[model samples]
Target: MDIFELDSAFVLHTYARRKIAFERGENATLFDQNGDDYIDFASGIGVNSVGHGNGRLAAAIADQASKIIHSSNLYTIAIQARLAERVVRLSGLDARVFFANSGAEANEGAIKLARKYGQNSGRFEIITLRNSFHGRTIATLKATGQEKFHARFGPFPDGFVYAADTEDVLRKIGGRTAAAMVELVQGEGGVLPLDEEAVRNLAAELKKRDILLIADEVQTGVFRSGEFTASIGYSIEPDIFTLAKGLGGGVPIGAVVTTKKELFEYGDHASTFGGNFLSARAAYTVLEILEEIKNSGKLARTIGYFARKNGEISAKYPRLFLGEAGVGLMRALIAKDDLIQQAVLERAHKERVLVLRSGGSRVRMLPPLTISKEEIDLGFQRLDSACRAADF
Candidate 1:
């Protein structure tokens, strides 16, 4: 079957997907069905962390697949246990973890745990920030603060509210308040990052009130933001955090990490594919490479190079861009307006530089952690060429 045609015919029309059908990818570049090159600044929306065609990761997946692709979670999986342990160890956050299949599921698991934590206390509310996205499942959709995601979806589950500021969050805290969840850098909320000082202050208040804090790290986790998680960079230790996207390196996996080990009982939550051998092995491979990158100074070097190049892009195109909109490899060039943003996206696509349109007039880039300084420079140069060719 023709891949693109079959997808158009059979797949749900949920996404305004790009036209090109990507055939394969290498380190930081993707090749389309036409065999044209597109430097993958988007990184499959921050999922391909170590990048495409990673030999070790591929070999590990092949090796594991031959052994056993999956098994009942009823049986303790060694790979799952190891991945969870590795995540907690590297994060340096004393926490226990539960695995799931996607960020939405992870967020759902987090909400369930927080609610269960407050079940005895009679507090079950979860207040997320305005414009923050948690996930798209029913409960997670309710957890999301954007009205755009909530239209026609109501009579949503109660005990969910959105805070527009620190004061609003404080005001919302009451007898029923259970937790406040945030995305340190709001990915879909236009790639806008929350102020660290404000976040720290708010977290302190939550702690004072004995309320849990949940950091939705689906998009910003896995060294995309220069830390294992952006919450670490923020210097705020949350009660719970959700992980997905890059965790499985391309395989699907979601994890909910919590400080409270005794929050859930045996019957509280479960998943069929959660923590299965296939995804866990893939994620373990990603962690191995990321640890190497973090230790060998490549992670820092790549982030610094990206920041410097982005600074140059802004300096050269002051008229086209307003500023930068995020941190680390998960960043965006803030276009002056929607038209400018569209122009940058289209023109850059013409130059074979793949990027994404994020919330808040931003053109986002989520390059692989494995990307080199040379590839970063090449992406920016191609973007610049696109702009120049557009005579802007």
Candidate 2:
């Protein structure tokens, strides 16, 4: 049976799957069943940080798999301990780590930790910014600032308040507020970065009130945002930060790093598959590659190349693209309208290029960090062709 027929017959219809089927991938390029190459600008929605078909990444997973897959959380896992140390060092916090399976789980764990930290004071409220996107769980859906995602998922967990700005956060941060979480750059919210001044001010204010600040760096962590962490750029020292997406470099893993580790006693929280040996190995290797590229200065060069190519695309098609906004490779190109946006996406696919429609008029690009400058140029040229052929 064909892929479509097989999926339609058995699989659940969660996502609107495209017609094309990719057979394999190498670095920033994917080959379809027809042996056509498509320059991947989506990178599996920012999960393939080390790139596809990476030898080291594959080898690490394979080597760990041959040894062990899951031993549950009942026993100590050395790789998980090593990965926790790695995360703490990178976070620059006197912190402890908790591993989950996805960004949503990470945020959920963080919420629990923050509430536990303030439970003695009857403070369980978490204030998130409007237009921010968290995970999709019952608690996280309520934590998400956008009301659109909250429509059908009613009767959500309580104590999540959506704020407009720092001033609102301050006003809402009475005795009931335990923490305020933010996505340094709201990836699903059209890749909008928070205002620098506002983030810094909120950090300071939260610190003064002993209210925790969590940075949801699921899309911006592991050097995906050009910096090691987006909070560093905003000068906001977050009390806790969550990592996922690129953390496993295509494998599934999630982590919540917090400075206050004593909030929870023994057996307070645990995940059956969290920080298993295989996933921990993969995550460690991804972090190792990120460190090497960052130290050698290649990461910065590649990010600059991406920004430059973004400019070239907007310049070449002034009406098609209305500039872009993001840090590093996580950018969204704002189009004229929904018609032009959808048309360009369809045309880009026709031109053997992959991009994602983030919002109604925002085309998101989250290419692999290992993508070369030459690959950026080629992707832009193909994107230009797509834009030229696109018709509203």
Which whole-number lDDT from 0 to 100 does residue 60 have in model 1?
96
Q: What's the CA error at residue 315 for candidate 2, in Å? A: 1.8
Residue range 10-41, candidate 2, lDDT tens digits: 98988899878888898899999899999999
Residue 2, model 2: Cα distance from true site in angstroms: 1.2
Candidate 1 local lDDT, 40-126, one digit each (tens): 898998999999999999999999999998887899899999999998997788999999999999999999988998889999999
Which runs in model 1 stand beyond 4 Å of their true positions?
none
User: Quick one: how many clashes does candidate 2 have?
Assistant: 0
Candidate 1's TM-score reads 0.97
- Evaluate residue 154 in candidate 1 and report its C-alpha lDDT on the 0 to 100 scale: 78
After superposition, candidate 2 runs with Cα above 4 Å error: none
